[model samples]
Target: MSAWAADRQRSRVRPGDPGWPSDVSWQQLNQQVGGALIKVESPIAACVEAPTSAACAQLFKSLRNPYFIGDDVALTQHLGWVDAWTSKPSAYAVAARNASDVAAAVHFARRNNLRLVVKGGGHSYQGTSNAADSLLVWTRRMNEIRLHDGFVAAGCGGHVAPQRAVSVGAGAVWAQVYDAVTTQRGAYVQGGGCTTVGVAGLVQSGGFGSFSKAFGTAAANLLEAEVVTADGQVRVANACTNPELFWGLKGGGGGSLGVITRLTLRVHELPEKFGAVDMSIKAASPEAFRRLIGLFIDFYGKRLMNPHWGEQVRLQTNNIMRVSMLCQGLDRGAAQHAWQPFLEAVSAAPGDFRFESSPVIVSMTARDYWVPTTLKRALGLVKVDDRPGAPISNMYWPGDQLTVGEFVHGFDSAWLPAALLRDDQREALSDALFASSRQWWISLYFNKGLAGGSAEAIDAAKDTATSPAVLDAFALAIIGAEEQPAYPGIAGHEPDLARGRRAAQGIARAVAELRKVAPNGGAYVAESNYFEPDWQRAYWGTNYPRLQAAKTQFDPEGLFFVHNGVGSEDWSADGFSRKA
Candidate 1:
């Protein structure tokens, strides 16, 4: 069931609402479902008839992620705020509850010959989740998490496959039921990014976490997977079942081998209320910023060899910047002591500045946070449209980590709309900033340790794909709102899509540069810094050919072809480009 599906009746919308699933399209599609595919009638029929629906109760079709089901104009609002994100139309969404749902979607797409896209939380900037015209298999409703057996199994299987055989296993998104008595019912499916990211997609990118150095990446911890091949057969993929596929998922990436349903992962005993700290500072000059950023590099080096040290810093790309910091340790006092040097560095600044520094223990268990509904509910933001659009393009800071093509030595780009950035800064200087309760704002994320987080575990053979040099990973985001406005003219709906392309290039550059610095820059399966196909080999290194071979064996029919899908046209047996 979708976490956001309150009730059919409660979700029912009246006439003035956004894209209220018109009887026209749904009815037509149901009638002409092609050949063997089942003809789904109402929302309930669509739910139960779904392939993955068998794993859970039939009452879940309406279920969706709490983040996905906002007002009609929410997408447009976000588009306005962002330059690279895609704002999907909700009517085309499938609220999958398990692996079976993904299987059903694949079966239906193949039978009906419709293009398909597998989605977890749809956090990608390239908008790969919302293809121009394709069947969207969304795993948002498959958010049910629990522990099972010695492995962890998601209520719905939404894991990603490995991109290249040499990369890693095909695990993406995150979470599962853990069965170890020591772990109780908890799982170690290692989720990436916010809780919203899927279990399957995260592990594919090499998950970065505070415990990565200790546990290895989420991919290193994986044991097995249940996959739905392109031909529609369900099978197990692992060192035993399909060793190549498993190898691909390790450090490889998702969206390659097949659609993952359930993941069998190695679970660990976690500590309660791990020590936490947060701090921020304003810079006086560019020299100070570099000095501070350079100081951080040293701490990063020490933390790499030290098992107990954990730290994250957020640096502004602008000349005059604000710094936000977080640190974690075995205990509060321990963390405070470890952070003293950083605090002293701030005091040694060339000029005086007010700083927010403190020590506070944070709750760590994975409990859902109840965000205040606030006015987003009061007036029903759907009550407005002209002001809505996708959020702005965001820049990420990998701290010291870099990629194969991206070089931070002289990195610079203005992802924000030029007008918007100038206006905001000028307004701030004038002591006036735009005020809108529903407006979306950019947020910086700081995570210590690349996917290969802690140094606790060392599997030389398994650690080949992993690296020890990377100390942190970070990303920028627009917390709320959908599309934002660029121009009132054709740009609003023209779908230029240049922003997505540019953002992808920028990320690619960063990743490329990192690959140059660290012979082994620690891979994070969850972060897919976009790279052009020609340059993709840089990210995968020696893993490309193996993935091509698997594609030839599994999808020879070439029945599946979609934009940004995967594989080149030459590899497709049927002359269809997987990423066409």
Candidate 2:
């Protein structure tokens, strides 16, 4: 057999394999990284050893706090998904504090023929950050932030004009960046809606926030990045330098291209006010719920399909509709006026609808929107980290609390085309939505779709590696179910396998209903189903071939691999061996 064929047959060295590194080798690596190497253990190790101990109790309590989860070397934001994956700690981790440290770890892992994993905020729903018997490059300590008034890429001095931007370390979360950019400086940077999600991961995954309709995706706003490629070479990628690598980094999925140490993103002018609308409407029967869905779809297409509105609306099995949408550049009165016509239509049919409560329309100063004090003291819509001595800014939305360390039963998403909102097609679209909700709750996330965005926002998203489908999509319909933190080996906290399987089935059926209308719809890689069959096409569309070429150029040896990420089809399911 040829050398290439022989190499393809070999698997990465495991813990007990003869090719595994010796104790001296590990010690040498530790010294090279300034003694930042860590001997990892399961986050629940203490709980397993002594379930009744005070330390174990405290650890379990800390699991519910996203800040605590992100700070640990072994834990991921999600514990795992049922049957799909379980968070497993690597045998060792190099707690990377800088690009040089990350490069050193990469060199060691490649030379040792070891499985490698990279983690930042550890928020991958597909469990890309955790693997057993591997060596981890953990970038949780590289948090730093800097603002630039007129930034230009290194090699684009004259060709590219200077622009306002922010440089953020991989470990910095959205909350930190928003506090610095929006609250402190009164500027805006597009990022994830979840406060604790890592900046690097979200940007790499084509991030969406409450204001994405106005600012575009996080990846599209990327100005430059500092990356450590598989060959341990630290390179700067931008529009003018290493352009191919730069294109791949935007929406190509994290942990596949390289380890991103820092990213620079373009900043936009902050609007005067940020606002939200919350209300619940219950339909007396299934017939009324169908009409309600049809009415909202028509209203959304006519009035709300613009740069101002974003966020989600929910269609539930209990014949109820919930609205938790947001807006920017519009104050209380304008937001209210935009929705008055729809509210009046519902009120006219009292025999079919009942209001759970009066619609709450409110607006606040744009600068104070992300302030912890505003969410806690003024709005009472957030849950603060109660641990003594924690930073006062450590707060998350009350609605987001359920996802911290959650054991997901199932999750799936699909982009609904803007064409579906036409008067001729509204009935088919509404029928699919109402049918899907019978099996599971359907959430229509309008911000994730860029169809009716500003021309600047749409053009920016077109330049990134994200699926082309998003450009014409009015909303991303997400169907999912989950249970609370349930890691294996914890007696009472173990996953309910039987129940999870049933939920998974319902999630599948719900997605099937949507497929009947949007047969070839593309999915968002960041929130797609773990068992997606045609992932390459589903995630990247025509962009997959270009992404593969970039992957081959940068990582010909296939050193970096993540589940369903770019070029991942070349490796085995567990990413330990190349497919023969």
Candidate 3:
């Protein structure tokens, strides 16, 4: 075996380990970062100590606010996954405010042989950003967003031409970025659907948004990045410099290869309009539901399989199909026109299907979609942060509110190949959807797949470390379940283990149904099954080997690790020890 391989066959130092850093060392490192070191604690620690205190009451209320959870170094958007992982505060956190601070933290962690965790938005459903007895590099204080009319990568001034782009600090979230780039500047940058997701994490995980079909993934749009690698060097990674590292940073999974300080992403011209088609149709019987699924699949394959449409369609166990799809570059009339055939078909079959509510097909100026006032007055579709001194612009989708501090029971996803949409294969695909829904509700996120995207979009995604399966898949089928704000040892907020376990089994069965049609499908790294047996292939496909090489080159000693991230196979499940 190789020297590095042999070296990894050992345990990592933990809190009680003899090699653990001393207080003096920690203090010295804290001084290096301008006294930004924080002793991390559970968000509910105050509640655990005094359940009846006003502070505890306030803490419970704050848990529902994603921004509040994100700002805290100890918490994650997802509290935990039942029977799998729980949110745990690190021993200490370095509240990094700049690349220098990040590098200082990295150097300290490496020197002390510490298990390091990196958190920007802290939204990892897999609990990747949370670990007990580890040091956290918290980038929340580093938020800074700047736009460039024209920008070029470092060391490629002559080779690559300048392009319109936006540079965002690692801690900056999608809402903040969208407000600047789209609402204010009248341009578009591909990002995650959840507005508060950290830009750095999403890009590194192959981000998808409502309009990804038009602009491609956030990773594919990356122009450059400032990353602090494990060696304590702050390096600029782009196509022109540290090319291999740059490739790995795109869709290679976050907190593995390096700590991103900032990213510059290519910007595209904002479409004239952005729109949505919201409707729910409940079939009267199982036979009707099967027909409804078949009809929708046919409609999607024929009319909606293109760059103009994105978002999702939900197939529920109640024999209901919900359409929450979005569109861009199209006016209200055109958007409605595109759906007329499907709507007519459902209407004609009124005996078999019934509308849950009046179908909504609405369109608005693309620039206004993320504007707080527009969202409030025009759509009435946002939940604003009510905390005192919160920015008026601090708003999130109501749809995202349910999972703010959820403890997931189970979550799994698989890419459904575009071929499944073919006329000859649509029946099998429809049958799979119906069967999956019977087990658990399944959502097909069209934007997460790249098959019907523009050639430029597909070409760019191919260069990233994401699974090749994504290039041919029309949608990503996701099945998941969660409960509100549950944490172990938190008196009344303890997780519902019995209920959670049942939901987990249902989720597994649901995904099994999808697997019948897509048995060899690859899964998205950022949002996939936590207990994926063959994670390397599920996450990166053939790209795993290349990503592994990059991880070895940059983080040879495995100082940086996250659950299921590249090169993590060498380490134990808890990431505190290497596998023998």
Please give the CA lDDT of all the candidate structures: 0.39, 0.92, 0.90
Q: lDDT tens digits, residues 1-580, model 2?
A: 9864476346788888777899999999999999999999875977877777888777878899999898889899999999899999999999999999999999998898889999998999999989989999999899899999999998999898899999999989888899899989999999999998899999999989988989999999999999999999999999999999999999999998899999999999999999999999999999999999999999999999999999999999999999999999999999999999999999999999988877999999999988777536566787676778987667678788788989999999999999999878999999999999999999999999998999999999999999999999999999988887778787667889899999999999999999999977889999999999999999999999999999999998889999999878888889998886
TM-score of candidate 2 versus the correct structure, residues matched by position: 0.98
Report the lDDT of model 2 for residue 62. Answer: 87
Q: Show how many residue pairs clash in every candidate, following the order shown.
A: 110, 0, 0
Worst 10 residues of 3 by lDDT: 3-12
lDDT of 3 by residue, 387-464 (tens): 899886677898898899899989999999999998799999999999999999999999989888999999999999
Q: Which ranges of candidate 3 are over 4 A from the true structure? A: 1-9, 374-379
- Give lDDT tens digits, candidate 1, residues 369-476: 111123432534111112235211111122211121111111111111112123333333111111110121223233434322344444521542322223333221
For each candidate in turn, the TM-score is 0.59, 0.98, 0.97
